[model samples]
Target: MQESDGPAPTSFPRPPNLLDGSRTSLRQILWALVFALTLPAVLIATAGFRSGYRAERETSDRRLQETARALSLSLDREIEKNEMVLRVLALSPAIAQGDFAAFHRQAREVGLASQSRIALIDMDGRVLLNTRTTYGAPLPDNWRESVLRKMQETHKAQLSDLHADPITGQALITIDLPVVIDAKVAYILSAAIGPEIFQRIIADQRVDRDWNAAVLDRSGRIVARSRSPAEFIGQLANPNIRDASAMSPEGNVQSVTLDGISVRAYFSKSPAYGWTFVVSVPVTELAASFQRSLFWLFILVGCILLGVLLAAILSRLIAKPVDRLVAAAQALGTGREVTGTTTRVLEFDTIQKALADAASDIRAQERHREEALARIAESEARLRLALHACHLGSWEYTPSTGAFEASSQCRAHFGQGPDGPFCYDDLIAGIHPEDRARQAEAVAQALDIRSGLEVEFRVVQPDHGERWIRISGRVRSGTDGDLSLVGVSQDITEQRLADERQGLLLHELNHRVKNTLATVQSVATMTRRAAEQGDEGAWDAFMGRVQGLAKTHDLLTATQWQGASLEDVLRSELDPYQDAMRQRIRLRGPRVNLQPGAVLALGLAIHELATNATKYGSLTLPEGRVSVMWAVALSLSPPVLIVEWVESGGPPVTPPRRQGFGTRLIQRGLAQQLGGEIKLDFQPEGIRCVITFPVKAVLAEPAPAEDSAERYAS
Candidate 1:
C-alpha cells in the first residue's frame, strides 16, 4: 500500500434532523387546535381562583387590622378614664397631709365606683394602706418592686406588667402614679384592675364571629382574650404572634393557631401602655369562596371536551392526502428517490415540487461552506502567531459550563503546559500570593455587575520569575445565547519596572536641589554679615564654608541622599586639621547616621569650630589638641543625637567682646536649621560646645511613594 500525503479521512455519524421520520396527521393537528383552546380555559380558571383568594385575603386582613386598632383605642380610653379617677384622688388634701384614715375612705369610695382596687405605698415600697383591707393591716410583701421603681424614677403614672393578686389570685394590671410632694416622691398610689375589664372592651368592638381578638402586655403575656379570657389570661402569647408584634407597630402575618389551623392575624401596638392588640381570622373562610370559582371552571372545561370529539371524526378524511406529501418531503431531505408519490390537495402538490428544487440548491451550497471553514482555520493560526509575538494572550470563559479556553501563548504566560486543561482556578493559582485576592475580587465584581473587566496583577512564572500583566475584557453573548467573557492579557513587566526607576530618580533630584538651595541661602547670609563687620579674612572664610558644603554633598550623593554616616561627615570637615596637628587631635564615640539636611548644617558648624581652634584656641600650639565625639541616645523616645566638641592645651580662652558672624551662626543658624540646641562656652582652658537634637528628624527616611511606577514613567 502507498503512504497517504494527508491525514486519513474520518467518517462521522450524521446528526439527527428534527423533521426526519416525523409526521403529523390531520387528526393530530385538529386535536392540537382543541388543546390550544383548552390551555386558555385552564389558565382562566387558575387566574380566577387566584384573584378571588387574593381579594378575600386582603379584605379580611384590612378588616382585622381595623378591628385591632379600634380595640386598642377602646382599651386606651378605659385606662385613661381610670387614670383620671386616680389623679383626682391624688390631689385630695387628706392624702397630701398624711391623713391615712380620711384618704383611705375617699379612695375606697372612688375604687368601688370604678370596680377597681386601690392601694397607697410609700417610696420605700411598703404598703401604707389598701382599700380592699383595713388601713395598714400588716401590709403584704412588696410584689411589684420594678413597677414602683419605674414610677419613682419616671415621676409619672405608668402601666405595670400583668400579675396575679396575692390575696385573690386574679390576674390584674396596675397603674402606678408617683405622689409628688414638693418635688419628692412621698408615696405611690396604685390602681389594680382585673383582666375582665380589657376583655369587655374587646367584646364591645363588634368583631365578627369568625374573628378572635386578644390583648397582650409588653412582656408578651395574654392579658385578655375574647374567645377564652378565663383560660388564656396571664399566659405567654403565641411565639409567632409575639415575633410579628415585635417587628412592627401594626402589621399582618399568616400563622397557624394553637389548634393547628392556619389563620391570618393582624396586630396594632398601643403607644401609651406598650400593649399589642391582635385579631385572627381562619384561612378556611377564604378558601370557601375560591371553591365556588373552581366549580364553574370545571363545568366550562367539560363543555369544551365534547366539541373536540366531533372535530376528530372529520379530520380522518383530510389527513390521508397531507400524510402522503409529508412522507415524500422527509424522503427527499434524506437523499432518497421520491418517484411517483402524489397528493389530491393543491397546496400539498405545490410543496412537493418546491422541495425537489430546494434539494438541488442545497448541494451547491455545501461546497462553499467547506471552503469557508478552511479559511477560518487559517485565520486562527495567524492570530495565534501574532499574539505570541506581541507578548499577548487570548482567553475565553463559558459561564454555562464554567470552562476556560486559552490559547497556547496564554498558557505559556501563566507557566502552564500548552496541552494541559486550563480552568479559572488554574489561572488564579499563577497570580502572586499578595495580589491574588485583589485580582480575584476584581473579576468577581465585574461578573456580578455584568460589565467590562480591567485589572493589573503580578504573575509568578516558574521559569521567568514575576511579571506584571494587564487584562481587559467585556461580557458578550455567544451564537447560542450564552454569556461569555473574552479578553486579552498583555505582559507589562518591563514598562512597569522602567516607570519605577524613573520615579525614584526624579524624587531624589528634587529633594537634593531644594536642600542645596537652602544651604546656599544660609551661606550667603552669613558671608554678608562677615563682610559687613569689615573682617579682613571674610572672603576667604566664606569660600571655605562653601567648600565644606560641597564635600558633604559628595558624601550624600554616594548613598542617593538617603543619609551620611556621622563619622564620614566629621572626618570630611576635620581631616585637614588632623593632618596638620597629627597626634594632638583625637576623634571618638559610636558611629551614627545623619540625614541630608542635618549633614549640611553640622558640616558647616564643624568647619567654623575647627577654624577657630586653629586660629586662637587649641591648634595654635604644637601641644594643643582637639577632641570630637558623638553618640546616639537610644534611651529617649524616638532617640536623640548628641555631639560634643572640646579643645584644650592652648592659651586661656576669653569670651568674645561681641557676637561675630561665627558665634551667631553657631548659636542661631545651626540650632534653627537642625531643629536642635547648641551651647558654646568660652572656658578658661579652651572652648567646649555641646549640640543636641532629635535623632528621628536627622536619621528618618522618606516613605516610598505609592504608584511610583507612574512617577517614573512621567
Candidate 2:
C-alpha cells in the first residue's frame, strides 16, 4: 500500500465570496481612506494640545519670574532707605560728641516721623538715648556681639534679621550705625524696626490663589511668613527649604510636594541680610485650566476614533475569511503545504481548489526538508571548528542528576591528561597554589547563590610550567531545587607575562628619569650658591663647571643612553677640531657598555683634555691628531676596560699651573664613581688622558625588552 502525502484536515469549510471582488474594491478604498485620516488626526490633535499647554506654561512662568524680580527690587530699595536713615543718625554731631539731651530729642522726633524705635548704644553696650520711653532703657544684653564688632571694625551701617527682643517682647530687626569720631568709633546708633512692616511688604507681593512668601535667616530660621504668620514665624526651616536656600542666591522656581499636594515654588535671597525668601503656589491650581483643555480634546478625539474602529470591525467580519484563503494559496506557492479549508466567506471556496492544485505542483519540485537538514549540519560543524581554533569551550549541566559534562576544549584548557578522569577536583588541582583558594571561593559562591561564575587564575601545566586560564560559568536549576554549575576556561599565559613585563619596564624607566631630574636640581642649587658668594671670576668658573656636567649627559643621550661605547665617546669629543688636523682622528675598540654614572664621568674627562688641546696644546696648530683605543681584560678576577687617549699633531703640551674646577672634577669624579684612577700626560706632541674602571656592571647580562602584547589585546 502507498503512503498518503496529504495533510489531515479540521471541520472548516471553504468560504465563498459574499460580494464580487470588483464591486468591493471601491468600498475597501473608502474604508482605507477613513482609517488613514483618523490616525493622522489623532496624532495632530495630540501634538496641538501639547503645544498649547506648553505655551500656557511658558506664559505663566514668565509672569511668576517678573513678579518675583519686582518684589525683590522693591524690598532692596526699602532696606537701603532704612540704611541711609541710620547713617544720618550715626553722623549726628550730638551723638558723636555725646551731647545726650540733643541726641535724645532728635531721636524721638525722627522715631515718631518714621514710626520706628531708635536708640543710641556706646561701645560698652550702654543705651545713652531711647525714643520709646519716658526714661531711656538699657541696651539688650542678648544681641549678638558679632554685629557690634562688625560695626566698630568696618565703621559702616549694618542690618540684622528679625529677632525676638527680650527687652521689648516684640520681634524686631536692628540696624547698627557706626559713629566715627576722629578715626575712632564712639558709638552705634541702633534702629529697631517692627517685624509687622516686613510682613506687610510680603503680603502686597502675594498673588491670589494658594501662594505663600516667607523670609528665612542666615541660620535658616523663618523670620516672617506671608501665610499663617503665627504658625511658622519662628520655626526651624523645612529640610527641602533649607537646602534650596543654601544653593541659590538668585530667585528660582521649582515643584515640591507639600501636604500631599505638589506645589510650585519660587525662591530668592536678600542681599542685605544674607536671607533667603521662598514663595510657593500650588501646582494643582496652576495646571487646572490645562487639564480641562486636554480633557475636552481627548474626549472629542476618542469619540471619532471609536466610530472608525466600529466601522472597521464590520468590514473585517466580511473580509477576514477571504484574506485567510488568499494567504493559504500564497503559502502553498512558497512550498508551505496548506490544508485549504476555510469557511469565512463564499469566494474562498474557489480559493481552496486553487490552493490545493498549487500545493501539489510545489510538492513535486520541493527538496526543502532535505536541504534544511544539510545546511543545519554544515553550520554546526563550522561552529565546532571555529570554537576549537579559538580555544573556546562550552558546558552543560543536568540539575536532575547533578551531573556536569564539559566539552573537549574545556578539558584541554585545564591541562588534564588525555584519558584521565575529568572532574571538578582535577580542575581545581591545576590552579596555581597562590590563586587556588580565590578561584575555589568564587566557584563556591556561584553554586551557593545559584548565580553565574567568572574567574581567572594560573594553571600549573603538567611539565612544571604555568599558564593563565580564565573560567566562566552559569548555574542551571531544576524545578525540584537541584542546581549544577557549567562554564568555560581558556589559556591566557602569554598575555599575562606580557602585562607583567610592561609594568616592570614602566616602573624602572620612571625611577631613572626621576633620579636624573633630582640630580639636575642639585647641580643648579650648588651653582647658585657658589655664584652668590663669589665675584665675577668665581661665577664664570662655576657656570663652566655646570656646563661640563651637562656635556656628559648630551653624549650619553647621543648613544641612546644604552651605555657608552668607548670608541664612539672619543670621536664625539675629538671630532670638533678635525678641520684643523684635516685627517688626524683615529679610533679602535671592541664595543663595550658602561653604566650611566661611569659613562658621564669618562665623557667629562675626555671633554676637558680635548678643550685644553684645542686652546693651548697640540691641536692649536693644523697638524694635531688623537688616537683612542680600548681593550677588555678577559683574565682578570673581575673584568676591566681600559681606554687610552693619545694626542700627537700640532704644538707642544704642558700641564696647567693651578688645577682648575674641570681638572679636579674629572680626576676626582671618575675616581669616586668608577673606583679608578686617571693619569694626565703632558706630551710634547699633544695632551693625553688615560682612564681605568672596573667592568663589574658591564659583565652582567643586559635586561631584554619586555613583551607588551597583553596590553593591546586587553
Candidate 3:
C-alpha cells in the first residue's frame, strides 16, 4: 500500500459523539440540501400545474375541431362516390338514345350497389324514369322540384338538403348531376341517398364515448347522429350550430344540445354544399380533467413535505454510525488490523468486525489461490475425453523447443499410434504436398500478427488414405514467457464432397432463374402488344397466364421439380369447371409424367383453351360439353405423346380474321416452348386443338436426357 500525503485515521471511534465534527457536518449538510432541493421542486410543481391546465384546454379544442373535420370528410366521400356514379351514368349510351327502359335497368343496378335511388328528369322538370319505381311508372307531383330548379341554376352538380320522403317519410338527400349534350341540358340525373349511409359512416369512426357527433344538411336538419341516431335523425340540429354555420363555414361555440347537455361544439360545413357536421364534448368533462390534474399535484406536494420530515428525523439517527463505518474502512485501506467496536447499528457493527479480521483473511486467501488454481489440470483430461468422443483432435506446438504434442485422437487423425513418437517432422510429413505450403503460410501469418490460426489442408493418412483436415488455433503465451499454439483439428472429407455437388446445383439454379425471368418478360411484352390494340381484357388475360405459370410451378415444386403427370396437369386446368359440371367436362389420359418445361407449355395452352371456351366455345352454353383425351404411342421409336381437346353443342363457331395473343401463344409459343407441333381448328360445331410432343420431353426419369430436356427436367 502507498502512503498518502493526507493525515491517516488511527482507529474507529466506538460511536461518533454528538459534538464530533463529522457528525455535525453531516447533520448540517442534510438539512441544507433538503431545503435547497425542496424549494425548486415546489416552484416547478406550481409552474407545471399552470402549463398542464393550458395544455389540456388546447388538446380538448384540437380534438373537437379534428373530429368535426373528419366527420365532414366522411360525409363528403359518401356523397362524392354517388356523384361519380352519376357522372358515369350520364355517359350511358341508353340515356343519349332516349331509351328510358334500358337506362332504368342500368341505373337500378348502380343504385343497388351504391345504396341510393336513381331518378331521371327532363329540362322541363318532368320525371322520365325513377329506379325507386320503374320505367314509365306513375310519377308523384312536385318531386324534388325546388331541388331541380336549384340544380338547373348551377348547371353543374348539386347536393340537396335533408328532407323526408313524402311517400315513405324516410330522411333523404339527393346528388343531382345534369347530362349536357352540345352545351344543352338534355336531362338531370338525381341519385336519392338515404340517411342510413351517413349513419354507418358516423358509427364507424373511432371517437370517444363522451363525444357526440352529428351530420347536418343545408337546412340544419339532422341527417345522422352518432348517438341516439334513430330518435334524433330528421330533426333540426341545435340552434348554436345553425347560427355558427350562418356566421362562417366552420367555427366552435359553447351550447346546449337538443338533449339539454352543455357541450363545447365545433362545426365544419361541407365546401360543396352548405351542410355541416358537428362534434361536441361535455363541458363538465373538461372540469373533471382539470380536477384530476390538481389532485395529482396535491399528492406530489404532500410527498415533498413528508420527505422533509423524514430527513430531519433520520439525519441524526444514521449520521454518527455512518461516520464510524467510514473511519474503520479507511483503516483497512491503510493495511492496518482494526479492533472491533460497537456503533449500535446492525450493518455498521457487522462491518467493523469484518474490517477487524480483514488483514488476516487476505493473507489466508493469497495462500490458497495456488491450491485452487492447481485443480485446472483436470480440465485437460476432460477435454481429451471429449475430443475422442466427438471424433475431433487437439494439438499443441512449441516452436522454441521444436516440440509437438497431441492427444490420442489427434494422432489417429494423421494415422499414428497413441504411444508413437510422432514429433514435429512426422506431423509436417503427413500433410499433402499440394496444401503444405498454404498451411505453412497461414501459420506464419497468424504468429506474426499474434492472432488466431485457421487452416484447412489435405492430410495423407496411412490408414484412411487422403482426408481433409481443418485446424483452428490461437497463439498463447506461457507463464515462463514461452509461446505456443494450441488448437483442435477435425476431418472434413464428407463436407468437401458435398461442397462439390452444391457448386453444380447452384450453377443449374442460376440458369433456371434466368429462364424463368425471361418467360415473365415475354408475357409482359405480349400483353403490352395486346393492350396497344385497345383490348380491354389485356390485363385480365395477362394475370391469368401469370397465375397459370405460378400454379404450374407449384405442381413442379410438389414433386421436387422432377416432373408432374399429364393427368395432373390437365386436372389442374379443368378441375374448377369439372367441379361444377359433373359430366360436361371430361378428361381421359394415361399417367404420362411431364417435365417442368412440358408442364408450363401445356398449362398455358389449356388455360387459353378454357378461357376461350368460357367466352365463346361450348362452355358458354348450358347444354355444351368439352372432352380432353391423350395417349402415349409406345409403338414409335423414341415414342411421342398426343393430346386432343374437343368441344361441341355451342353456337356455330367461326375463325377470327386475325390471331390474338391467346391464339398465337397456343399455336406458336406452345410449339416452340415444348419442341413440338400444335394445331387449332374452329369448326361449325365447336373448336378442336391437337398437341404433340416427344415422349422424352415429358419423361419423369429419362435415360441421361438430351441437352435441352435436361434444362427444365432438373
lDDT of each: 0.75, 0.66, 0.78
lDDT of 1 by residue, 1-714 (tens): 997789878876653333344455446667888889878877877787778777876786787788788677666656766665565566566877889998888787653334478889987778888887887688775677887778877667888778877878877888888886754678898888877788777777776777678888998898877776777788887788899888888888888755466887888988657788988878787677678667866776677677677677667766776677766665655543333355443445445654765577686889899889989988987987788778788999877888898877778778889898789888988999999888878777777788998999999998759988898888878888888889988888889999999998999789779878877887788788778878888888888888988998998889887778777888888878775435666665444667777888788888889888988989898788887755554433445666778888899999999877877777665677667878677877779887877766676443222222011100
- Pick out the ten consecutive residues of candidate 3 with the lowest summed lDDT: 705-714
Candidate 2 structure quality by residue, lDDT tens digits, 99-184:
77777776665422244777777787767667776545554542557877888777667877667888657777777788766557
lDDT of 3 by residue, 254-278 (tens): 9988888899889998765567888
- Shift of residue 16 alpha carbon in model 1, Å: 65
Clashes of each: 2, 10, 0
Model 3: which residue pairs collide? none
CA RMSD of each candidate after superposition? 31.8, 34.3, 19.9
Instruction: Select the stronger candidate by lDDT from 2 and 3.
Output: 3
**Could you tell which candidate, 2 or 3, scores higher by TM-score?**
3
Model 3 error, position 491 (Å): 22
List candidate 3 segments past 4 Å from native. 1-24, 111-115, 145-154, 206-209, 326-714
Model 2 CA deviation exceeding 4 Å by range: 1-409, 417-421, 432-441, 466-468, 476-486, 492-585, 607-625, 633-640, 648-654, 695-714
TM-score, per-candidate, Cα-based: 0.35, 0.37, 0.48
Runs in model 1 deviating more than 4 A are 1-52, 111-115, 134-138, 206-210, 295-714
